[model samples]
Target: MRGARRVPRRRVIQRLVAGMTVGVLTTAIVFAAMGWFPFSALRPREVQVAETARIAALPTTIGFHDPDSYFMNDADVNQTFDKMLATGVKNVRLMMPWAGAEPVQNQFDWTNIDRTVNAAAARNMAVVGIINASPQWAVAPGVPAISGRPASPAQYADFCAKVAARYKGKVSAYEVWNEPNGAQFFAPQPDAPGYTELLKAAYPKIKAADPNTTVIGGVVGSVTDWGTWLVNPVSFVQQMYDSGAKNFMDALSFHPYHYTLKFSDGMAVANSPLDQTVALRRIMIANGDASKKIWATEYGEPMTATDEAGQAAYIADLLTKWQEMPYTGPIMIHTTRDRQTGSTDPENVFGVYRTDWTAKPAQVVMKDAIAAGIPKSPEFQRFSAITDPSYGEVLTPVYRATPTVWAQARTVSTLFETPTGIIASPTAVADKARQFGGIPKTPFQNGYQDFDLPSGMRIWWSPATGAHAVGGGFVQAWVPQLGMALTDEVRDGWSTKVTFEHGYITWMPWVGFQVTMT
Candidate 1:
């Protein structure tokens, strides 16, 4: 059942890896690197919102995860790109299979990939190349050799670096290993730290190769948690963040396959795959990374037992639902063409086009949906203090449409309830009354905000550091200092540091906080 573009049913696949268990944590790397700098303060004596903060919007676009361009003839590939252009597609996710690219150690064959990248680039389509499929030499002894990860993170990192360097301006983004949460793609068992290692090692090299290209992490598996071999998107993402994944990757990628359910079916009803993103959003928010985007790299419905029109309706509904999720980036439809026609298996038919290259009802639905444009979710204003206020400063400047909305919406919906616990704020500020564990004792002054927690700790925020709790040992350490926290605790490579108006505190992994004065 595991052919070119199809994945087996979750129920059936889980039984295959039945007694398997995921390694909860990977070994934390302690680098003996040497680099430090003096605190050049960002908190001005008199702060202004315009000078200190900015907000930009992320617009949604539709694309495809098709293999025609990679395996088809040159003329056929050009035709495929032309069809995509005609369908109003703006993005494409192509595979840069590591096994096929580098069969021998340090040796490479860029034939199919170069063709795919060049074709997409020629048509002005954005390409997100997924770097996966480990080769024989790269896989360690006894690891499930097929689609297994390289034994060392450096090997995968090197391959990713080469792809970035080769496709410099062509590839818009790179998805680091597809569905590592599933044993099918990751092999043996899923490991969060192992995946994080690949990201940590590849991220810097990818950035060094092409700073403009986005490095997407967390290409999680199916919607719900069925077994240890296939971790749920939410749990896997949480584990990734725990393993220091936040510092790496430009955006988080996911495959929210909703099976037979309609996107309109609420989370409680469908066990909604799209709503699953809200949980991932919460993880990002709690980790001080609400600003980043979550990409739906693969999603679609199969036309096996269902009516073609019903499949089209499913796609149409998905498009409408995704527009309300502001945190979502581009959505790549599973495949452009069907793997087989008249096949009883649902896995072989997740395509908008038939095997004969004829357009299906879903294709027309997709074209119309893209033409209509996507809107910002209504809840976009809720997390403005943590996400919106610093948008332009943190990420690259992308053109957002009118009305100035923030990227994500669902995470802080509950936190923004009123004093009476009723109306939510139309304007964005830090979380409302009860969220800081206490009521805000200060007014919103020119993009700065704070609240006193019940634990006697204070929550401070800045455009540079979002929102962070300054309490306990850090507060005890700060009580003897000259001024309040000017910035939140931040991690740079190996060490964690926070700056005050007069001095700062730095903490290493094993070593606790070290206080330093200006």
Candidate 2:
């Protein structure tokens, strides 16, 4: 009691208060600084999709969402996916409404969701499960229990954890919410902070439940709407990054709906769906989320396209352009069938099929695109856009693969892309590289990747050379011997000549001049 007298309570309290104050100030400063660039660019130019304007030949069985899957009977659900499979759809996106999944606090109901996921799994299709919209019991008194922000982030996280734990391996990915940037989707007002909070909460819960399940942030809508009624798409996303959103999402999602006749336009337009993707990706790159891919989760031209045939054409065009995007994976075309054809709401007409599940002209084009292994116009010429894979090895320069093979493995994140995108089947590349009697390396580096196969060969891809083998016998014998990967591609009268390497390989009308070697 003499030497170690009781500490002064006032001094102890003062120290604690000072520390807390400093911590709060430091956090405030960081958050403020993060918003500097964003606040400055409140109204910026719509990002243009220049080099990224090329289209790809996506597999026919792309992923589609069922707007009413939760309410649909088992028979209807089965028929929907079955019809999808028959038409080449390999994946589906289903919703696990927080309200329905756990109606009474802890009384979780996994029955409907379980059936949806298991049904897809049985069809060998993947499912992208989503969790959002708070329940009435969980939210504040008389809050209307909308499909927007929850009672709190914790409640949303708890719900997500339950969904993740229950579905674990069945669901391929989990999107935080639908369209948080839209007032209609997020409710009250589009609060970017609240959405970020939701992601911050839900991402970890889903990951903790199953690390393999991909966690995507809330899907975003059009970025070029002039930032009037709702949050600016780019700004909303920028705020998300500033608020430490990158740490929370495995991938970014966007819905690039073209409002008017711009549906058939090229990606160069500011409002082009492809342009929207390119712009969003630019934001990702600037915000240090370039490692993450952008999925055009929902995009389509509604049946407002005058005639039913016009709607079909719009679907084909939109799908074609999006499939070409290098930054995208599993590009979904909204829905398989129109949800509200009988209602006055035009939004219900985005489906490729009628409400009765009958195929529209667009649906027919889709099926044909899948069957032909490329996007082909049923009425127009059958264009061989992506290379004919049947030719053992389709040797073409990057320029030759333009419009179809613009981006490949290096810009890739999904297995689907790794197989059919730029490199055009890593399997075939690996097998061929092995035949060359050389140990191959993983496709690494930036943007497009280079593969170092045995026998002094390097898989180099530039805008000029496209993607080709340089310096080795693997490219030497093309026709007679076979199994060779030659940049035998030529465009604009400049077919790839297997001349002894001296400099950059180039062609006109596609990839411009860039660095190369001899």
The residue-by-residue lDDT of candidate 1 on 1-518, one tens digit each, is: 11122243432112223332222111000000100001232121221111111111133578888744555668878877777877888688887877555554554556667767777766777788888876656777766433567798998898889888777777778889888888777877788889999999999999999898888999885545546666777888898999999999888987777656665443323224644666677688789887788887888888864789988887776676665555677788877877686788776687788889799999998888778775333443333344444222222111111123222223222222334332222122333222333334444444334444544555554545455556445665664453546665577999878787678988787888788999
Candidate of highest lDDT: 1
* Candidate 2, position 223, lDDT: 45
What is the alpha-carbon RMSD of candidate 2 to the true structure?
19.8
Report clash pairs, candidate 2.
55-324, 56-323, 56-324, 61-88, 398-466, 408-422, 438-454, 490-495
TM-score on alpha carbons, each prediction: 0.64, 0.60
Q: Give model 1's clash tally.
A: 0
Model 2 bad stretches (over 4 Å): 1-61, 223-228, 262-272, 340-343, 375-518
Write candidate 2's Cα lDDT for 1-518 as tens digits.
11211111111111111221223234223223322112223232232211111112132336677656655668988888888887777767787776555444555545556667767877877777767655546555434443435768888898889777766677778889877776555655677888899899888888999898788885887644424336557778888888889899988887766545433342324444444555577678777776677776666656654567776676676566554444556667667778766554556676777888888787787677767755533311212244444333211111111233232211222111222333333433432333343233345333122344344565544344344555444233322222222353345464334432343344333654332344
As a whole number from 0 to 100, the lDDT of residue 176 in candidate 1 is 92
Q: Can you give the lDDT of residue 318 in candidate 2? A: 59
